[model samples]
Structure formats: C-alpha cells, structure tokens
Target: MDQQGQNGLMRTFREPWRSRGALAYVVAALLTGFYVVLYWTEWLTPAAVALGLRSKWLLYGALYSVAMVGGAAYYLRHHGNSRYNRVRIAVNVGVQVALAFLLPLIMPLFGGPEAYLSYFWPLSYDKLWPSTLSSLPVYLALYFIVGSLLVAPLLAYRYGKRWYCSWVCGCGGLANTFGDPWRHLTASSTRSWRFEKVSVHTVMFVAVLTTFLLVLDAATDGATGTFHWLVAGGQWWSVKQLYGLVVGAILAGVVGVGFYPLFGPRLWCRNFCPMAAMLGLFQKLGRFRIAVKKDMCISCGNCTTYCEMGIDVRSYAQSNQSFTRAACVGCGMCAHVCPRGVLRLENAPREQADKARVRLPVVDL
Candidate 1:
C-alpha cells in the first residue's frame, strides 16, 4: 500500500453487516421501521419525555450525535494515521453535534428561533419558502436568504461542495461517519451513474418548482384560490405536504439512512438530495478535481471500491485523467485508498489544471 492508502484491512465484503447480506437487510428494515415510527406516531414522545428532551426530534438529534461520535471513533481507529482524514472527520463530527443538533435544541429555550445553521435551501427545502421566512426573525430570514442564494454557491465555487457536504452538513456528516462501514457498497456501474444524473437533477427541479409555487401562493394570498390550494393550502394532498412527506420524510429520513447497509452511505446524496444537486452545479464550475498521476495506476480498484458516491475512479486513474465529477462530495477516499499514489484532490486555476492534464499520457484502457 502507498503511504496515503488506508492503513488496514477494510474486510468490506467479508463482513455480513457491511456487505449486502441477510444482516444488512435486517438492519435496513429496523432503521426504516424506526424512522416510520418517529415520523408518523407519538410512540417515541414518551421516551423523549422520560429523557427530559422537549420533543422526539430532540431525542433523535441526541441519538444522531451519539451515532456520529461512535462511528467517528471507529473510522479514526482504521484511518486516523492520515492528517487529512483525522481533521476532516473531527470537524464534521463537531459540526453535527454543535450546529445541527445542539444549537437548534437550545435556541427555543431562550426565545430564539430554532435554526439549523448547517442546513440551507433546498435541502432544508422550506428555509426559502415565503411562509417560513415570514415567520422567522429578520436576522435569521436574511441569514437563510443570503446563505442559500449567495454564500453556499460562492463556497461551492471556491472549494467545491466539500465545504458544506463533507465538512458541515449533517446528512453528509452522518454518511461519512455512521455510513462509513458500507461505503464500499455504492454502485459504480454506468447504469447507476445514468440514473443518478437524471434522478438527482429531477429532484432539484421539483424543489425549485415547489419553492416557486409556494412563494407565488403566498404573494397571491388566496386570490388564485386553486393554485394556492394546490401549492400550500392546509391539505394533505397539497404540493408542500407531498414534498414534505415524500422527499423530506421518506427519501431523506427513511430510505436515505435506512438503506445505507444495502446501497452504501450516499444513497440520498447521490440520487435524491436537491441541495447536493444544486451545489453540484457550482462544483462543476469550481476548481476542485481529482488529479490523477500519469501511468502509475496499478488497477488495484481500491479507489472505486471505496467511493461513497459510486464514481468509477479507476477508469479515470487508468486513463490518467485528471477529472471532476459533479457527484463527488470530495470526501478524499479515492486519494486515500489509492495504493500507488495516483490521485490527489486539489483546487487550482483552470489554466494550471489544463497544463497538467495535457502533460499526462493517457493509457489505453
């Protein structure tokens, strides 16, 4: 193994829970069931009360923080030798605990708005909605508007989506930590990539459309009665309700984490996250790329195998292609797992990247 490669055996396929084995399915079922109960029923409310938590969401947040902490320790035990991995995991875990979990939980007690600093539109999905913004304090409303419309895209353009997706977002944090064990299970097939391109962007479009309709409904204020009813009226079948039920509750909460043992950690990030889709557009215009060293790839397959996003990294390595994929969350696993030191993640000027790519000889695949 190269110096940057993983330090010990992952034993991914051999492990029943990590592999798509019977145990994996069982775990998935349990997770799905838990989310179902949490979302639809009050069964966990008593548990929350017993624990002195204000709501089931607070209980869920506490559990989520614990899982990330435990999983981070497990991940560090195997990959902590690398400074990048160590620091990234630590920062990610810290962000989840403090900003995502604790901050929101504590804010309401002091008569402040409950805000998840780590989230923005369209992942939070409602942050930009006119109704939601109107209900918030001016500072928080401005924060969401500026953060989502300007700051998030600017950061993605400068550092790629990694600044948020890898280092700050709770979804990505949980995926990198708790979902680390099943990272190898992400499908790298061309079919999977095709589906991802269509599905993720489709979700993005719907999110934008939904937000637009919501804002318009608020502006009309029931004058466009049917449109208002369809968009955001208090009805079970309203667009807002459906999006919350299907995209937010089912896709993000249930399928995303629940299917992790079977589909890998990035099921949501890769194929369903509207926020990822939006940021990915900025990432394509950004400086981030995985620079592949020329003619040094041994075809060991570790890089592709460990990619949580299902990117076929070995093909790029074999072709000596310094490349950027929109799906890449910049988790650094490809560079970390390459046994021949054939890959590095970097941010550089377009001219420098072009020059470097031109110098590298493309091997026949």
Candidate 2:
C-alpha cells in the first residue's frame, strides 16, 4: 500500500468490527436496543438514579460527552498529524461537551430552563414550535428563532454546512470520532447517491411542512380544527408525535447511531437529516468547494472511501473539476487523504470557481 494518504491500508475489510461481520451486527443490535429502551421505556431510570443524575437525559449527556472524548482520542491518534484535523476535532468535541451537554445540564440548577444552546430548529425540531418557544425564556427563544432562520443559513452560505456539521453539531462530532473506523463502509455507489438525494430532501420538505402547520395551528387558536388535531393535538397518531417517533427517535437515535457499525456513521445526516438538506442548499449557492489540481490525481480511492457523506470525490478530483456538491459536509477528509496534494478546500469567489471549472491540460499548467 502506498504511504501517501493519512490513512494507509487500514485493512478495514479484514476487521470484523469494521467490515460488517458478526461483531458489527452485535454492536448494532446493542446500540439499537439501548436507544429503544432509552426512548420508549424507563428501564434506565434506576441506573440514572444510582448515578445521582436528575434524569436519564442528563445521564445520557454525560455518557455522550464521554464517548465523544474517548472517540476524539482515538481519531486524533490516527489523524492528528494534520493541524486542521486536530483543531477541528478538538473544537467539535469541546462544543459537544460544553454547549450541547454541560450548559443545558447546569442551567436548570440556576433556575433557568434546560436548553440545548447548540441546537436550532428543524434539527432540534421543536425549537421553532410556538408552544416550545413560549415556554422558553425570551432570550433563549429569540436565540433559537434568529439562529435557525438567519444565523444558521447565513453561516452555511458563507462557510458551508461544515461550520455546523463538522465543527459544532454533536451528531457530526460523534460520526467523525466514534464512527471514523467504519467510514469506508459508507455506500458511495450512484444508486445510494440517488436515494440520498430523494430521501434527504423529502424529509426536509416534511419538516418545513410540519413546522408550518404547527405555527398555523397556534396562530388560528385551533380554528383549523382538523389541522390542529392532526398536527399537534397530543395524540400518538398526530403529526408531531409521529414525526418525533419516526424521524427523531427512530431515524436520528435508533438507526443513526445504532447502524453506525453496519452503514457507517452518517446514516442520519446523509439520508434523512432535514437540517443537512437545508444547509446543503445554501452551501451549493455559496463559496465552499473542493478545488482539484489539474493532472495530479492518482485515482486512489481514499477520499471516496473515507467520505462519511458518501461523496464521489475521486470523480471530481480525477476530472480536475473544482466543484461544490450539495451533499458535501466539507469535512476536508478528501484533501487530508490526497496523496498528490491534488485536492484543496476553498471558499473562493464565484467568478474564480467558474474560471477553475474550465478544465485545462497538464501542459497548460
């Protein structure tokens, strides 16, 4: 194996845990079972009490932070030689520990609402709901509203979804860290890409529709009786409850983390995340792109293999096509693993990107 990429011949296929063997299945089963019990049952309540935690959620947060920290160590051990990888992973873990977990845990102690400051609407799902916003403190409500509607999209437009997906989102942090080992398992086939494009945007549309209905119900004071009942009337079959059960619990929790061993870390982000879908739209309209150097690619598969988002990076690199794909999370792994230094992540002006898209022969360079 050539020693050019950051990861050199991991023998991923030879390892049972990484290669979808029996151990991988077992791990997936355990993870699925854990989430099922956590979301649907109070089986873990006793364990949370024994740990002196107020609720199972806090206990889960502690465990989540620990997992990210442990996984970060493992990730850094393998990819830490690059300054970019080290800093990005460190900041990601820090955001998970501090903003996502600890701050929410500590806020209620000071007579404040327990809120995930790091999360915003669509992904947070309930953050934009009128009832949820009314329940929160005014500042926190504004934070979620403004952050979701303005700040988040603006950031995605300026810096790409990586600003959140790679550097701050707990989901992405966990994927990059704990899920790093099985990244090569992410299906990069054309069929998978087509499925991803359809499924992700469908979920995004559903999310927007759900939120719109909830707001309309609240605004009309339930005059839209059927819509109100169907959307948020506290019934199990209601849209809110169904979405929570299907999208939030089943997709995000159960299948997302649980299937990591078999399907790779980004099962949720790549195929189902409404937030990623929305951000990706803004990202495509923005500046972030992976610029490929002409005549430099060696056709090695490292970039495609390690892309958690299932992007066919080698195709773009080999063609010297400096481009932005809506699905790209801008994780920078393609550049990190490029043997010939053929790939670069950039936020250049649209004119420059347009110019670069015109292919040139090696002699012209």
Candidate 3:
C-alpha cells in the first residue's frame, strides 16, 4: 500500500472515536440509560418477573442486548464484515435470550424449576457437594458433569477458549462489547503477565481444594472430627458467604464492571476468574492457536495494542510465532485490528512443534 493508504488505515484504528467504535459507545450508553430507567421505575420487576426472569436473567439480558447489538454494529462497520463476528453476536444474544427469559418462563409451566432454569457455572466447584448432599443431583450434573467435564473439554479441544469466553459467557460478552474501549487499560508488561498467571491459577486451585473438602464433609454428614477442624463450616461460610455472596456478588458483579475505567474491562477475567483458569488448562493442550505470518507483519504494534489479554501479539508476529497463550480469551480484537492481515486463528496439528508452523485457519462463527 502507498504511504497515504497506510497512514489512513493507521488513523482509522488509532482514532477509533472517528470510526464505528464511537457509535458502539453511544449505543451502549443509550441502552444503559434505558435499562437504568427501567430499573429505577421498578418496571424491571414486572417485566422480568412476569416473564419469569431471575436475577441472573436481568444481568444476562442487559449484557447480551448491549454487547451483541452494539458490538455487531461496530464490527460490521470497520472490521471487514467477518462472518465470525456476525455469528458471534447472533449466537450470544440468541442463547442469552433463550436461557434468561424464554426457557425459564416456558419450561416452568411444564413442571420445571419454579424460579429459573438450571444453567451450569463451570467454575462453581463448591456447589457440587452441597448439591449432591441436598439430593439436588441436577445441580451437580449440570455444573460439574455437563459443564466442567463435558462441555468445557469439548470447547477447549475444538476452539480453545473462544466458545465460552468470547461467544457464550455473559462476562466475556460484556468485555467484548461494552468493555472494548477500556481494553487499552490491560497491563502489557511482563511483570503484569507473571502476576496474572499466578493469581488466576491460584484462584483455580483454591476452588478445586474447596470443592474437594466440601464433598468430603458432605460424605461424612458433617461429623465433628478432624474434618470439621479442617473444613470449619466450609459449606456455609466458604461456599455461601465467601464464594457465592462475596466473589459472585461483590467481586464479579461490582468490581469487575465498576473498575473498567481504572483497571481495564478484563480485570476479573484476566486476574480472578477461576473458570478462565480451568478453561486455560485445557486450552494449553488444545490444537487451536493464532498463527502469525512474519513476512506480512509490519511491526505496527496494532495487534499487541488491541490485545485485551496483554499478550505481545506484535512480538509473536514479528518472530513468526503462533500465539499459544493459555489466557487468551479469543475475542479476536488482535486479528481484527491487524492492517496487514498477518495473523490467523487456526487449529494446528499437535505434532507441529515449531512456532513458525502454519495451519488451516478456523473461523469460530
């Protein structure tokens, strides 16, 4: 491309306020206002309860609506109309709508749960034993067997973390769309990366350990012994008070969203999300990767600048290496912002050891 073309392209990416990204911010703001009014007027209660919407549903709906619509609008305008982005928006909105409102309202009439449908939370490990002890085996089945054991591995194998983190998760959906602007806040330093690796994985380990103890306590029917000393009212204090109330409500609900301007949109996902850590474990063994073509790379740093996970994407591209970072949520911002189209997300064979190895591209949409 000519100098003029390169300059224009750079300007379009750098000054996103001059492009469709600004429109997304406007749409998000408008929708947020509408939602706030709906809640302030107490209209959300009727609209939601009448439709059998649970608390989770309200969150899911607002997030899905804003993220999908606004995100799609922005991507369609400036990101070359990729099929992946289009289908990602559609699937995210459709699935959230179904899970949040339609299914909960419809299924209960046929004798489902009186409050809400059973949606699995993959990293909610502490819930497993309580579920089994309460004889609500369904929760165990859904959260552990279906979500953690089955769906997670399948998705990791097929598409790394993209299936959940980018396309389906409410948290990820929020980050991808509403959090797009604040993505630059992600710390790109190697020290930050080291801290991220330790913190998130530590959370995952704690989750697993807590779950194991809870299950053990449940099995013994809460006998007062060494186990009690070890667990120490773990079921109520740890799971209910700490994990459910504190982590779920305060950390994820409040700090995660509220700290967007201060610490980037992915503060939770990048630092404290146990589910991400669990998925990243499987992702390390997955065939999927983002391959960088060094010949096409211009070292413009657009890829790294847009990387929400703080991976040095430009370095990877310059060195002709494939990105195998386990923390990658696969939001596609790096690939989308690349002017030279040097990077591609693909499934390389396991036998391919070299960082420069190329493979057939895979479009997640």
Best prediction by lDDT: 1
Question: Model 1: per-residue lDDT, tens digit, 1-365?
Answer: 33545665557688888888899999999999999999999999999999989889889999999999998988887777778888999999999899888898899999998788888999999999998899899999999999999999999999999998999898999999899999998898867887899999999999999999888888888688788888887887899999999999999999999999999999999999999999999988888888889999999889988889988888888887888778999999888878788999999766664545543322222
Residue pairs that clash (backbone atoms under 3 angstroms), model 2 = none
Model 2: per-residue Cα lDDT over 1-365, one tens digit each: 23344654457688898999999999999999999999999988899899888889988888889989998988877777788888999999999999978898889999999899888879999999989999998999999999999999999999989999999899999999988888888898877887999999999999999899889889999897787889898999899889889999999999999999999999999999999999999998898888889898888777887888888788777786888888888888888877788888888777665655653222100
Give Cα distance to truth, residue 346, candidate 3, Å. 0.5
Candidate 2 residue spans exceeding 4 A from truth: 1-5, 352-365
Q: Model 2 — which ten-residue stretch has the worst lDDT? A: 356-365
lDDT of 3 by residue, 102-219 (tens): 6655665776653222234434444355644365446534655566667777788778987888877767767766666567667778778878899888877776776777777767
Task: List the candidate 1 regions with Cα displacement exceeding 4 Å.
Answer: 1-4, 8-10, 352-365
What's the lDDT for all of these models? 0.88, 0.87, 0.65
Better of 2 and 3 by TM-score: 2
Query: What is the Å distance of residue 211 in model 1 from its true position?
Result: 0.3
C-alpha TM-score for every candidate: 0.95, 0.95, 0.76
Q: Report the candidate with higher lDDT, 1 versus 2.
A: 1
Q: What is the lDDT of residue 62 in candidate 1?
A: 94
